[model samples]
Target chain A: MKFSKKDLIKLYTNLVRARTFDMLCTRLLAEGKFVSFYHEGAWGDAAGVGTATFLRKDDILYPHHRAHGFPHMIGKGVDPKYYLAEHCGRATGCCSGVGTVHALFEEYGILGQSAILGAQFTVSVGWGLAAKKNGTGQVVVASFGDGTLARGTWHEGANVAVLWKLPIVYVLENNGIAQYVSLEKAYPLKDMASLAAGYGMPAVVVDGQDIVAVAEAVGEAVKRARQGKGPTFVECKTIRVTSHGYGSPHMVDGEQRDMNMVEELKKREPLSMYEKNLLKQGIITKEDIEEIAKAAKEEAAAAEKFAMESPIQEDASILDQYLYAE
Target chain B: MRLLQYNEAINEALSEELARDEKVFLLGEGVGVSSLATTRGLVQKFGPDRVIDTPIAEAAITGCAIGAATMGYRPIADLMYSDFLYTAADDVLIRAPQWRFLHGGRQSLPIVFIAGSGGYRKVGPEHSHSPHSIMLHHPGLKVVVPSTPYDAKGLLKASIRDDNPVFYMFHKALIGMKEDIPEEEYIIPLGQAKVRREGTDVTVVAASYMNYLAIQAADKLKGEISVEVIDPRTLEPLDLDTILKSVIKTGRVVIVDEDTERCGFAGELMAQIMEHAFDELDAPIKRVCAANYPIPSGFLEKFVLPQPAQILAAIREVVK
Candidate 1:
């Protein structure tokens, strides 16, 4: 599947925007501007952006918690201001300040996500069920980290997805770590896509650092799902260039990551790699790359300003108001 | 009025709901040939699309109901036995109930989780326990425990229509019990207490199968000791006002529950009665619940479960 020049630029713009927003949020976390814990997506931008960029507005998306879902939501066309405000616990947040950084853009088919890892696998089946029953050709894309695959719901949900042939694409961003545990330590299989065979679902593995590769792989899965080909498991072998979360230890299994390996992983950072690829293909010149970077920075600044200006949610009435629908 | 068994009434409710709305569907491990008979014959009426028989995966079944609910569909997930709820506790106790609140209350999960609860089938510890107390401890879930076929049909219809997540716990002991229900469609709103047997000496608050026991105990002690029985069908939206009104009239109360005594629904009701009507009490409130132990199977089960004799003894002690 070949992408047009327009698609390449859009993917590049999303990759840059996701990185800028993530960096700004990390800085804000360090400055104590936000109270919630931050998980930096770091080098996992291509997996998030590529998986979600081509999805239709009606297609449901359950984003992984990497970078607090900035890349996926941004790729799905949601403005970053509401996301920042949600993290800041401001009244104007997407969830009205209740969800601390969780994204819920219902209009773009991005419903809420669970704080419990891998809980979305079971729920994604229902979305797929609804899409199939609705017969509108609206596919569901459920993204999660490699660690989440170990959850029992993954097997149960996958079995049903294949058995019923639900229209869904299970996008696995294999970052090789769940919190502080490495994938090699947690999972027996090096290629997580092999697990999909037991469910009789088709599987693919891609270079997550390359935006075009990730996009092409996920785009084909999405197309297959839309065509009623049941579900597909696409494992993007990615890397977490930082600790599990901001301000957390860089240790995995009580051993500090070798600084050299960390530096080596950072060398293939998604934004820079995608930028170079675009420049080589003449899809975007160095000047265009700088312009995109500047615009992303400006957008991040405006989003931060909007979040800072929003009112804090401290009213006691919200306790009862949001507890249950009348 | 036509007669229906407790399980049959539940089947009717599910059938009516599925027929009434296109969005309503049923999914469970054996819903096509339900073991409890609550969902039997549903698959044939609704077909495979509407009546989904899923694998034995509680978390997946519950999560599918919740997920489908969010997408403008009402899903009724039947988890054969209430004891099996532990397998899907995360989705039932946390996700389904908290999903709406955590997401700013913008979404409503119109999902119903049906499970057969309590002992009498002698199904042992894993299969025969009534865990409504665990659900009551959680704030977001609406709990319904019906004692009779009439109440079962009415309350289930109401639970299906309710916008929030409702845990409908039917007693396994009462599955074969029969009673008359109106031919016309009727829905008993949640949180309403029904005065089963009216008396003046003591107010007996009970639920589910215990409500049936309380009524029997009240009849046995009739003329000797007048006992007023109040069955609170829904526990979460508890009809505390009705119980308080009865407490104000009788001035003495005894709560009966099949769940264990420690931190049970009976204890919670006793505390509320004490808090609201402490001044009106003429004697100390009493609770007749199962002993604080796992319900053993067979003949040993009677020792662990609450009996009618215990209700009588508690009533006598409270009225004194």
Candidate 2:
């Protein structure tokens, strides 16, 4: 529950990095750099980076498409050029620009990122089962949104994970809204933690905006799993300040629809909130935070230049490759 | 040569594969104590480490197999019945097929998906059916339907060794049928067809249990019609070379499929034949397929399924 000076600084650096990366993605999409882009705001940084910091090199992280920040947080030293190239759909990108941004990196432990809801939850079980079967004691984290909680595979996968006592952790990012609809309209339950109780696994509800709180809660879950106990469901009450897809309009066709919660949701920017808390606690100066933000922006610019120059993915042999391991 | 039942031959293949490679393991409901008898005694042979018995979570388990396959483990998922394929279709049909291509060929998914397919012994509408053709609709996954015990052992071995995901179906009615299989280890390469009968009159295409029926029909009308029954054991990467050769020699083709007539594999075969070898055909490619309807309970199931009489009629019509 306590923290070190290095911990807070590391957290701040990752949040800044993620925010800058996300901003560049939005800017490129606006400039028509790519045909499509899924925009997740800066609010997701604390929860994504917080959880990823706890994973060891051997441990696996299976993220949904919305959690691009998780891999960016996994290691700050990753060449942003490869990631930017992937965004531009270039042959120089990791996966030769053929992979979407979600499924980009694997060497950094970003094993997979599925677009389908709750699909990774089930798939991670296999990874966890293998770890246990091999006696490796390695843990695999399965991350998804609150909307995916209603999916049958989530429960189906959780059932086997708990029954077999597999080393898998479920981290649910509860952003309160699925696409356009609010949680109240979709799930009858107020707290998703109770769903874990049904499977007899320990569950916790944490403040997603607080990176310290998320790390502490997920750290315990990771420990318990590594101890050969079972899976843990950690539901973080998070925020999403932008529209579900690329740019906001929340509209169908050409017409704009009603969005009453945007202004209220905008009030709690996680980065700003964390900075205010840090200042109040007398841990850091305003100039220090500014320095972090400046560095992140510079890194983002370098990645952008690299992506612009990268070549688009094209090859005559693409047809024959990737169909089989042979 | 040794006489082993269909399921026993399949069991031998699993045992040998598991022993041959420490990475190969079986996981599914009823695998510890195989309900269909195909996976029976595996847990005893391999122990719990290799033969895993999971709860009835089809979709999730299939996802688990895919993920494990990504991490260099060869997993054989038992679906219990092929009808329950819908429970796991999203991962098997979507993710498993695309993972190889999606990652730019960096990852190879080596997983064998095994299921009991066919309508017999009144397992009812949902349980008693073969959806192999439906599986063919998904690109990049291999489909294997083994009719005889010898092919069952060989193809199962070949599927496990292949780097791609192979969906293998075992005919429920043929599990008890016995055949003389070689004592020495063997693997019939996937995408190879076997000629059950040699004839110049007509080429009868059948698979799994349908091959058995086609052979029976060929025998019943032996003197009058010389029916050449060719079993294209593996659906994808189909041995069109052998099939087209027989088509040119016979100049007539009769396809018998248990799948529904509408949007079925039989229709796909007919189209491919027309596209490649239209000039060799003496008559329109004939088809004896199940009705485009669900298999209801009771004697109606038998009526709805493809029968030898239908194959006989198709042979007679095509030969004329």
Candidate 3:
């Protein structure tokens, strides 16, 4: 389970990149730079990055709707420029500016995400079927929030995925809150991974704040899936450091979060915690951290520039073009 | 040419497509047994890998079809009854249809959602209903409602080959109906309407089981009213051109639909006819559709559903 020093650095770099891009997008949204809504992946970076950083380019990923899948896409090695362009409604966007948050990158097995939550549970099963039929050893990782577990699709999808032993890994980012409802009020069980027991699928829980821990747990699940060992449920108990989405209240159940609790949770902030761990273990020095932070900021700046300069779609004829296959 | 029952025609199309393409697979709750008899004995030929018997989960079945299609495999998801489409509304109505378009047309979902549709089986409100109009409201889906065995086989074949999501709804009442179809491989292209009986007095546009009723009504009123029965095999890629031509010639139109009257296919067709041939109309277009109420079970269903008598009355009214 021990990652090589180089792999660790790569994971660290991806986490920083995801956080940087998310922060930039959130700031842009607040300034009205873009009209699209954003769900910040502020403290939940490791759940997406660690689970996706080691995946093969051909491996399919049904990214979680949180942060609009910025961390997951970046972890899978896709450049953020086109995705940024999509949010800006530029013609150069991945979906030709038609889909702001739902972008497709077929080469990396990044098909798209549904606006309706919990849809990935069922759709990912099909990808698993295809991978098994093709004998390509391509695994599918379907990520969703804790709130998505309440959907009926979770039961239906899990039952089949276990029955057929489809090559899929269901990663749950249990960030305590699903929009407004708290996790305690949503499900009866403390650990959502127990939901997998009804289907007899292997399940595990990992700390969402630790990128290395998430990578190790999801890495094992992905390996099992690739080896045709059926599906596995990996739950990352994480935190939502901000509101459900940008420009939304931080209240859960019509009550504001305790300011003291919010401050305490911020101390376990993923970025700073990982940086401190890397520094303590001698895995990365102060100067290395500074360089990585600077490079991520520069990359985010370049992507913003690319999106801002891209042309906006004006002609109405393009609307009918992608409606159906001729 | 060989005479085949509607269900047999569907089975033949599925068998041939499974053999024609390796990527094509069948998945449903009872696909191996196929209570509808359309998919019976398919598992024995294609084996379990292709002829998958799934849990009674509509959302998973449809979601799997969408997922498999995105990965370049054509999936035929059977919902048992088309009325059950409501169970997987997100996947059937939203995901399958809009996935390709919303993703900027980079992906094509080559999926066929086949199910038994319409009343006459007296299977209660849940099983005996044709919700094709709800599908029509959604733009991306292609809908095929075949009234005859020949059209059933040909249209189902075409739907499997299509590079988009197609809902191939076979009327439950027409399952036993038989017709002569060519033995050789054939595909009835979607969006083409068949003029079941050509006439010059009044044009009757009907679909699925209603097409059969329209033909019966035409025969019953033979000498009095010249009814031109136009069966639009595929509703989404509707051959409005053919219907308009008939409307222009006859100057009168009557639409027969098995679905409810309000916001039904009959209403949509009538509006389109008026829009295109307003001046040519000899009278206001009439429609014979099921009353706007939940289709009741038992003999009461007959009262709510469209009947040959209603088709006759609509034809007589339009001709007047």
Candidate 4:
């Protein structure tokens, strides 16, 4: 479970890419290039990116709707670009231009995200149960915001996962908010980790701002799951870097942080934090940082080009592929 | 061509489907124990892996079935009674049907939610109600109500094979009524309506066991009133063609459903007929259905459900 510089570097680049993509989306929507206004997991990027780094290519992950960072971290090659295009309602998107943000990459075992709060919980457990039955050695990760825990499916899924000792990890990105309301208003239980403890499963709360910390916690849970220790719940206490949607909703909030506070958080950015740690340990040179950033940008740029230049989905084929009747 | 109970037809369909496709499995309360008789001898045939008897957790069973379906297994999840379906509606409406659309059509969920609806032999309010009307309100969900043995077999096969999640509802009362069913496998495509009987006096749109009552009422008034009975097999993507054709021929209509009369499934049919066949109508549409209340315990259940007499009364009023 040793955390290496290369791993830290990879995780940092992905987090930066997630923020970059979210920033681009904001500009796109404001300019009307993209019709929908979407916000990334501004507060939950570290948790998403870090946990994703622990998942193998074949391991499955189901995300919440705002989990763009998670998909980018675990996506196979140029798939995330096409997926983003699809989410933006572009014709050349990953879901064959049909779905935008909730696309599933079956090849990479990214089970897609859900618009409904806790619906993915049971499905994740099901996938874990299937993998366990087939002896596939694959662990399933079901990630959701703190808001979704109020849903019945969460309890139903959690109870069954513990009952069967299924290989799954429930990731709770508790950014202290649930939509317009904060977490305290939505849930009576102050600690989400305690929520899973009642189901006889281990639950832990981690600092979601630190990529290595989030990664270490997720890696341990995933390892436990693969070893058939059943499901674990990880509650990450994090903050959203942007507003809930396309623009900064907090810009108008009188309780907004001053420029100095914003700058402080920026200095402690997930990527910068991970890079600084690796640099301090002398595990890598400055050239390594430059190469990774260059490679990540190139990958993102190529994916965007492919997605933008791809052909639009035909109108006639809309319903053709819906059912597997062939 | 022989008489079989409505429940028995469902049993036959399940047995045949499981035997035919190894991918098809049953998961529900008492399914392995053959509590509904639909899974009779299924445990012996497929064993525990396929014929799973689950705890009384509808949400878990439905959730597990949806997950299994995603892994390419065709799972038939039985809700012992239609009333119990609400326990798992989240999976049926939110997860099962919406998966493909949400995933940008990258995935398809092929699962069957089987449940018995309509008045049974005094099974009380919980056991006798039909909830397909409520389910039909949701898009992407396919609702199948089979009224006969042949239809039960054909539609059940179709539902098992369809890549989309389907809610297959059967009337407990119709299980005893048998019809000619071929041994070979065949499928009735979803979203199609069957013309049970054709006449020119008035059109009678009925679902599940109510269709049989409609047919019976139509037969009783054959010489006096030529009643056409149409069964819209799939209620969600309702077969408007057959219904409109019948309505146009008769220029009058009566829609019969076992669900509640107020904003029930019959209203959906009535609206469709009125909207598309308005110009051809000779009179206002009438619906014969269960009263706007719980089915009630004991004999009251029979009184609440739409009977042949009630359907005949509606037919007479529409035709007159």
lDDT of 1 at B197: 93
Native contacts, share recovered per candidate: 0.69, 0.73, 0.79, 0.45
lDDT of 3 by residue, A1-326 (tens): 87999998999999999999999999888887665789988888889999999999999998888888989999999998898888888888898888888869999998777889989999998999999999989999999999999999999999999999999999999999989889989999899999999999999999998888999999999999999999999999899879988989988877998778878888778888888888898999989988999999999999999988999856578767777887
Clashing pairs in 2: none
Q: For residues B248-292, write the lDDT of model 1, one tens digit per residue.
A: 999999999889999998888888988889999999988888898
Better of 3 and 4 by TM-score: 3
Candidate 2 residue-wise lDDT, A269-297, digit = tens: 78888888888988788899989989988
DockQ of each: 0.82, 0.70, 0.85, 0.49
TM-score of each: 0.99, 0.96, 0.99, 0.88
Per-prediction interface RMSD in Å: 0.8, 1.4, 0.8, 2.5
Clashing pairs in 1: none
Candidate 1 CAPRI assessment class: high
lDDT of 2 at A90: 79
lDDT of 1 by residue, A193-249 (tens): 999999889999999988889899999999999999999999998988888889999
lDDT of 4 by residue, B112-200 (tens): 99987778578888777788878877767889999888788778888888888889988777766767666566777888998888888
Model 2 alpha-carbon drift over 4 Å, by segment: A67-80, A251-261, A280-283
Winner by DockQ: 3
